[model samples]
Target: MTPIFPAKAGHSVRILQLCRAIKALGHELTFIHVASKLDTQKPDIASHVAFFGERHFLHLDNGPRQARFAFWLRGKLRRRWRKILRGFGHDHSHYSGLDENWRNPWSHQLRAMDRRFDTVVVEYAFNSRALDAFPASTRKLLDTHDAFADRHRPFVARGFRKGYWVSLTPQDENQGLRRADAVIAIQAQEAEHFREQLAQYEVSERNPEIAVVSHYIGLDQPLPDHGVDHAALYLGTNMLSNQISLRQFLEHVLPRVVSSIPDFRLRLAGSICNWAPDIPNVEKLGFVDDLRAAFARSPLSVNPTIAGTGINIKLLDAMGAGVPTISTVTGVRGLGGEFNNGLLVVADHDHAAFADHIIRLSKDAGLRRSLGLAAFADAQRWNERQLAALDHCLRGDALTDTAPGHVARWRDRTPPPFPTAT
Candidate 1:
């Protein structure tokens, strides 16, 4: 089950694409999800769920009397608990800084709808607890969006809390994956990591089955006009990691680019615009309904992500839209053989170099056109390869090339398209 409706978020896009692909391959699909109480914006849930033959939304019981009494009892108990913990010189922080009832609070409802499907795919590590509510006969699949233990490093390093960090510890990820009959990681690196982790728990030669299925956008040909807009698009939600990346882009990269290329502009789209800095020439277009129109207006896309795990689908989306992209190393991980190729440019987290690349590309119309076309081609190839891997994994194929080190078997040795091509 997903934590929210398929808004413009990366995880949401990945799930919808996978569901559509699964359905297109002649398998029935259904979605089991919980709503995010804090987000009032309603995404097009009907259109997304239309691919699936069935849908179920699990809701929590919250009568007024029950809510008031629960709040009162929680406050009373929290005060007493804090007092006792303080007496022992321990920090009694807020109880589980996660969404309320994140641990399968609606499992009773989920359990009732369990037997209808032969296989259940639970998305996100936090919602893995829902897997436990399913019957033993049901084949459970865990779609881990990222390696959370690694993803939480930035938060942990910022002194978030031991309790919070512990919640995403490696053991916690292991617990979630261990429960699944099969596991799907978004990146190849993470998929390998899961196999190693599961090996420790399994006595046999094979442990929990695992596969790498990257996000597939299946975008059509390049945007028509590559000459009109000199804007660099930054599209993403207000995820903590995205906010950090956008802040860095504003503070470090945007100024240098604008200085070198006076005509350059930056457009921030998606929910992250809520907290983004209002800088000169940087327009914040929050929650745009048509992302392709935004991409069409911008020739270049930049991802200055400082800290995050898993593949950045935003970067891939830019590539899919047939636009030239520049990203830091952290933003381009798990892109086998795509890094530093002609598909996109890469800068070593250096703002000056990033700005220079932006300036260089801004001046060369031919380079931009060629790179965008090449990116479109690469996206098509990667989409095919990833789909094949997904089909293989779903068919219960035993893990191949299970040797220790990082496997590069999926890499395409074909060279990127020529930049001089029309």
Candidate 2:
């Protein structure tokens, strides 16, 4: 699947899990993307391009050109039968956007790919022009990492403005939800929201269909470091919520959090955008390449966000290492761990109340230790490796692979297309 985000911005864990799943299942898979060629230019190949595959396709020139030819030749997914039957089997399903730049034109290619495979796994509710692109027989799983429209449109940078797929209106994304065979929500609350919104928008569906799958990171080997322990801290990069959340914590949350504690410092780390505050105890660490050194020194990782969707794997990362942690209710969205057990406390939605909780946690080291111990204990219950298996088990097509036989045999089946009005 195409994941548009950079590897560093928390998408690596999920991608790695997917890679591991494919490997464990013994699937002879191949990844086609511009990254194959770009890896030669990367300084750190060991870290950046770690996934092993039968083929690392360099499609900077050919694939897109083929896709365009396919799009033109196929004229929507169903009509391009002969073109798709070549090279790849008719069973070859397509996924992810080639690039965010192609967000506008990706619908056709995805739709074409949709008809090609018996299952189409969509990561984003991108290009909606080809809404019903999935073949009637093909299983469609919408693995939602985040609520794009909610986070993007109302974010601090482009508040309420329209983005490219003016059609991906909450209305349109909700449409993809209705059309999808199943919906996979990363966080529990978002899974609930997916169900609620689907019904609210009257997308035809029964109940209990949206699957709540937590975002996972496979840590087969134990992490040697437990992270730094100190006062209060916030760390993230480029995300809109990180900008607003940190500001809210520094201005409204930290003072109350440190009211009882003396010399409490809140370190702000990661690549930041739109710097708007100057707090005394706050340390600004712009663009941290290796967070291990930083995590090794900090006491608590604080997340004070009220907006956005998906489980914060960042919070999981902190808890995984037995680091003292505190998060806003919205921040610890899908964690199965308990407060004072895995995480220290959930910041109350009210600013004063939230700060008060942080203040208490910051002042009490005994409390931090107790929480850190509990958090580590809870980490035992979260098996990232198992989560990958469960995700793969969701569909029948995902149940088979290696040789293209099952998919290759589909060359004779006719691909169904959606109505043009959409």
Quote each prediction's TM-score: 0.80, 0.65
Candidate 2 residues 138-225, lDDT tens each? 6666666665544433532444222211123455557666656677677657777777777777556453356655554433222344
Off by over 4 Å in 1: 1-6, 36-45, 48-105, 159-166, 198-206, 339-347, 398-422
Error of 1 at 311 (Å): 1.1
Best by TM-score: 1
Model 1 residue 335 CA deviation in Å: 1.3
Q: RMSD in angstroms, all models?
A: 6.0, 12.8
Backbone clashes under 3 angstroms, per model: 0, 9
Error of 1 at 303 (Å): 1.1
Model 1 TM-score, 2 decimals: 0.80
